[model samples]
Target: MIGQISEASPEAPYLAANLYLDPAVISALLIEMSDMREPPLDTGFRISKADPELLDVWRRLIGLLDRPDEVPVMAHHFEHELMFRLLQGPQGALLRQIAGTDSRLSNVRRAMRWIREHFAEHLSIEVMATIAGMSVSVFHRHFKAVTSLAPLQYQKHVRLTEARRRLVSEHDAAATVGFSVGYESASQFSREYKRLFGASPRRDADMVQTIVDPGP
Candidate 1:
């Protein structure tokens, strides 16, 4: 997102950029998708092939990135068109769940958000279930179905992922970072860390450092 200029493509080398799209646009799209009552559309997990029309529309939107002065006025309009196209596409129903208050997916999403904010805290499945407004058994099933992880397993994953980021970038002590992320025992942290990342934290950190800071 920063820097003078960079190109991304599917050709020789690929580059990726993080785009922070306006949440308001996504919310509006979700609402539009969910409100349709005529026989629901087939909501595929992903679109296997690109639609020519949508692809052209996307190209037009991406063109605006080169025109900084016009982006403020033109971005919202482009986003609206893109949202409409998505609502008419195969993933429409999947996108609708993102904005639905009554949907079980929405409830699970709320719980996921809470877990992210308090990943280092002692998490209770019962408490998470209460947050999602479902009984423990029901919430557990739906949550696992949605995320492919049990609640505590999800927390451990989040904790370890965060620990890896801090360890790689900040060179924090493995034991200290482990406790900071919520594990009480350093040995437990090391065991889980190795299991997930395939290396001790120290080794992983060194490997990352070598990749990012290779010097003459």
Candidate 2:
């Protein structure tokens, strides 16, 4: 998956929250709740305003952080309830596909996993298609439709993103980081890295380091 950028006013406090849904948990909930003949979801991503009920559920779940002892006893219940609320919301179709064993989204996820695992290697569309259990044509269309990126583009994203992380965390030289992420030409790597990140790898690494560990 790719990262999204967010902006906040300098004078305002920014709060962001994310919940990771386990497919296994969703599947279990589907079994206990109403029938799940949900329609196929085309896009793997969606943005919807949270209903009041869903917001309340999140509030209670986050509240448990202040009551750590109650977490062991009530966390599971809150999680299950959260999923139940999500299952009843506009993103229900997306949630359903994640739990479906043989869905287009799941199939695409299969290929995506392979790409992330082998990001530094040469990418083969045929191999990715096989992993997704779809023909190359169908796989390409669905993959792009779901992720808004072609397969190769996704791999490049994975590579450059990984390269940036390594540059900062591993403190590797720009050339070495580029090569480690599958670029044969340092110029090509620097060009693309700048295009994506708005700075050369070395410069970006330095900027991030300055922000993370400003000297006394």
Candidate 3:
């Protein structure tokens, strides 16, 4: 099962919901979906105008959340249908372009992947450009186009997300986690972390833990 709910407008507090269901199980459906061939173009999935039918389906799906255990199942179905519709829609051109070519967008994606996988180490635009098979200037242009963030900014986001995750699971100090994520200066790490998350590491960690394991 899958669904979506939309507020009346950007500022509305209440939402109208819709739901959808398919006979196939989510995992099996995903496998079959992965096997389907795609067109060779740069169309990304986008919904230009809202569809009432789709909105109705999404509302019904939201009704199923009364059972928490079924949330994952419903979410999978919702994503599958949403993606399918988007791919079949007009904006799918951007998606197709990225999918079909060894274009700059592809290079940006490659660089992003490498940065995510190796964020614990020092990152240089030169090294990233080499991985993307482009000159530094070209790489920067493409990277900015695809992500709207510079390489270093993207790296900081990755590092911060990872550091926050680690802070929740590991018993290490904030400085230790900062250094492990490639920051040599603890104070710099603290400052950046606060800037991004709007709170210091220790405070952020406490909030995350409270959310993860709440008390009565």
Best-performing candidate as measured by lDDT: 2
Pull out the clashing pairs in model 2.
none
Residue 158 of model 2, lDDT score? 94
List residue ranges in candidate 3 displaced over 4 A: 1-84
Write the residue-wise lDDT of candidate 3 on 1-216 in tens digits: 113233344577665444332323333344545443444422222347757755555665676677778877777766566545544556444544454447556667778889999998888999999999999998887677666678889899899988988898895799999999999999999999999889998899988788766699
Ranking by TM-score: 2, 1, 3
Model 3 CA lDDT for position 24: 34
lDDT of 1: 0.77
Let me know the TM-score candidate 1 reaches against the reference structure.
0.81
How does each model score on TM-score?
0.81, 0.89, 0.64
Q: For model 2, where is the 10-residue window of minimal lDDT?
A: 1-10
Per-residue lDDT over 52-113 for candidate 2, one digit per residue giving the tens place of the 0 to 100 score: 99999899988988899999989899999999999989988899999987999999999999
Model 1 segments more than 4 A misplaced: 1-14, 17-47
Which TM-score value belongs to model 2?
0.89
Tens digits of per-residue lDDT, candidate 1, 1-216, equal 013224443675553334344446767765555456433322223445658877777887788878989989987787788767766787556656654666777788789889989999999999999999999998888888777789899889999989988998888899999999999999999999999889999998798677666688
Candidate 3 weakest lDDT stretch, 10 residues: 19-28
For each candidate in the order shown, give its overall lDDT on alpha carbons: 0.77, 0.90, 0.70
TM-score, predicted candidate 3 vs. hidden true structure: 0.64
